[model samples]
Structures are given as C-alpha cells and as structure tokens.
Target: MISAGQASAWPKFAHILGHDEWIDMPEFQRVEDRVKNRVLLDPMIAEETSKFEKNVLLERLAEAKIAAAPVMTVADVANDPHFRDERSMYTEVTHPQLGPVRITNQAVKMSETNPYVRGCAPLLGEHNDEVYQSLGFTPEEISAWREKGVI
Candidate 1:
C-alpha cells in the first residue's frame, strides 16, 4: 500500500495546482525505478528480501518519495471490470463445523460444484487410537506404547 506521506503529498499538490502534481515528483521517478528494479529487472529480488528487509526497502523508498496503490479487498476484486466475468471467483461452501463458509474459487472456474470441507482441523493426537488400530496394534500394545512415551 502507498505510504501515508505519499498519499498526503500527492493530494495536497494536486489541490494546490488544480491538477495532478504527481507527474513532476522525483519521488514518482524513484517509485518507477524501485518497481522496475523489483519486477522488470529482477523479479527474484522479492524472494531474496526478507520481510524485515522488504519493510526497510519500503521505508527507504518512502524517504525517497515513492508512492504505491492501497491494498484491495475481496469487494474490490468482485467489482473490478477485469474480473467481473469471473463471478465464480467467490463461492460458498458448507463447512461441517463452521457451517456456511465463503471460499474463493479463483483456481478452477470450470467446475460448477462448490468445494466442501470434510471437517475441522484435527486436535493433537486425536486419531492416535484409530491410527494405531489400523496398523494392527492391539489395545494393550497401544496402551504400552503410550505409557512408554513412544506414541
């Protein structure tokens, strides 16, 4: 997302000049350079940079007067003209535990059926008994393993 400073500066300049002032900002040039460096020049730079390093880079970019777009939400995606035809992008599923859950179908649109969740996440060691039984272990053997801190 664009920094608060960039958002503030652009609007203020635009208001004063009665037109977009971002066209003349050196910060804009820095932003273009940063994007070009990250995306066009070396896309892998993003993977190389850690979260902390990325934040630091962004801070440096802000200091150099670069701007960015704000983060978009699901509503924004649904309303966007480019994605409007992809209405199946948003779908609802019946989760066994959570009841009706909204899931994104952005992956495969050809399938008309909504995805279904089998169940909630398993609790730690909840299936120990069942799994051990499936492996042909008797109740006594399972109890012995648990007592010996092996299970």
Candidate 2:
C-alpha cells in the first residue's frame, strides 16, 4: 500500500480509526504482515518471552516511528501511578457494599468547573424505590409493584 501524506499524521490515523477502517484498510494489513514476518518479529517475540517489558517495546516502536502502547487491563491501572496518583485519570467514590472504588475521572477538563464522581455504581434495585417515587408512585404502590415483581 502507498504511504500516507506527512502532514497531520495523527489526525488521519484518528480519522481512519474513528471510521473503523482498520479491519478493511489494506495499509494496516500490509504493515501488520510486515511487522509479524519480515522485520523484527522473531526477535520481538523472543524478547517478550524472556524480558517482556512494555516500556522496552514502546521505546522500540517509537524508534521505528510507530505510535503504540501496550493494551492495559483494568487491574493494570490500579497499580499504575498514572492512574492512581492525585492528578490521575481515576477518581474514587464510595460504593454501598464495596466501600471506596476507583472509576474513570471526567474526560473533559474544564478550569472553572472541574467534574467529579458523585458516588460509585449502585447495587441491584438500589434506585428502584427512588425512581418509582419520582415517577409519582406512592410507597404503597411501589411495594405493590415490588410484590408483583414488576420492578
């Protein structure tokens, strides 16, 4: 496949990615095949089997002018300083059953009105009563609906 133009490289990649073109893009397939076969595939796999450091892989990719990052699992963020630090992309909220739990912080950063987590995810049926009441249901009616398994 032909190489993309040099200007605003990331935006083009983002545009293609946003359009979900990676699966169908011939360029992506070509690059994947090359990386998996011709280039440093065997050495990279060997390095992974032994040392297997994400940072090392990232550095190698950076050297090759490839922008990439290791796929991080949910547990990975808990131990990572970038996620758990004070200025992290994570925020803590109190869960009724689980106590304090960390979740994604507001993605949109605003200087004047910073966003925050109000509370952790609710437990099953936790908001049923409140929701029913808000919809003009009386406690008796809610209890009747609950008895009928409608909620």
Candidate 3:
C-alpha cells in the first residue's frame, strides 16, 4: 500500500494508479441455466479464493487518500491508524460491565461547550432505568415496565 503522505507529495501517483492491473474486472461469460430454477451461471468459476471483481487491493490505489490502507471492516475502524492514533477519533470509555471500551469521539468542536462520548453504547434495557428515573419513574415502576416488556 502506498502511504497517503508519500502520494500526496507526488501527483504522478494518480497517473500510475489509473493504469494499475486490478482496475478493471476480469472478463467473464454468464450462462443461462433453467431446470428447477432459472439463473445465470458463471462460466468463470473462481479458482482463486479471492474474486477479481469484488476484491481489488484497495491499499494500492495511491492517489486516492482513502484507499491507502487495506480494506477495513466496520469493526476495524477503531484500530485503523488514522482513527486510533494518539490524536484519535475514538476514545476509551469505562463501561460498567464491559470495562474499558472504545467509542467514537464526537465530531463537533466548540468553544462554549463540547461533544464527547459519555460511555459504552448501551445494551438492551441498560439505560432504561436511568431514562425512567429522569422521567420521574421510581425504581419499582421501572422494574414493572421491564416485566411488561415496555422497553
């Protein structure tokens, strides 16, 4: 993968990336199959575990800054270099049961007030009691609501 900083300094990276090997999908022929069901069958059955059409090396697209890293899943975002660095977009929060947990930091910046993640994303019925308490429901009432499947 080409690092962002390197390619940002050189515009030639864009020209090179446009002509890379995996840019276009490999040619394939589709067959019409009908018996029990009608479906298009792929004659180009994949021998490689990886498929060319869906599995381009995102890390090799140097000019596009977003493509500098290997493909990251949703769960991988927290650990990605740009997200998890010293100056991070994610922060550590101590959840009551989950212990130290990661959560996304707020995107807004303000001088008068600030935005931040307060705790772990709540589990089912986790913050129900707290919300009920704020709404002036007693603990007993909150418990009754839980039993009644109100939350």
> Considering lDDT, which of the candidate structures 2 and 3 is the better prediction for this target?
2
Q: What is the descending TM-score order? A: 2, 3, 1
- Tell me each candidate's TM-score: 0.36, 0.53, 0.39
Which pairs, if any, clash in model 3? none
Global CA lDDT of candidate 1, please? 0.54
Alpha-carbon local distance difference test for all models: 0.54, 0.58, 0.50
Which stretches of candidate 2 lie above 4 Å from their native place? 1-53, 146-151
lDDT of 2 by residue, 108-142 (tens): 66889987777777788788889988999899998
TM-score computed on alpha carbons, candidate 1: 0.36
Angstrom error of the Cα, residue 14, model 2: value is 25
Estimate, for each residue in 12-85, the C-alpha lDDT of model 1 and write its tens digit. Answer: 42332233444354544354543444444243322332333445655644664656443468798777665555
TM-score-best of 1 and 3: 3
Query: How many Å off is the CA of 75 in candidate 2?
Result: 3.0
lDDT per residue (tens digit) for residues 1-151 in model 3: 3332232322333234342332222321111111112222122122221333333535334324444445568878766686677446887899888798767787665779977777777778777678889999999997787799886
Pick out the ten consecutive residues of candidate 2 with the lowest summed lDDT. 1-10
Off by over 4 Å in 1: 1-19, 25-112
Residue 144, candidate 2: alpha-carbon lDDT: 88
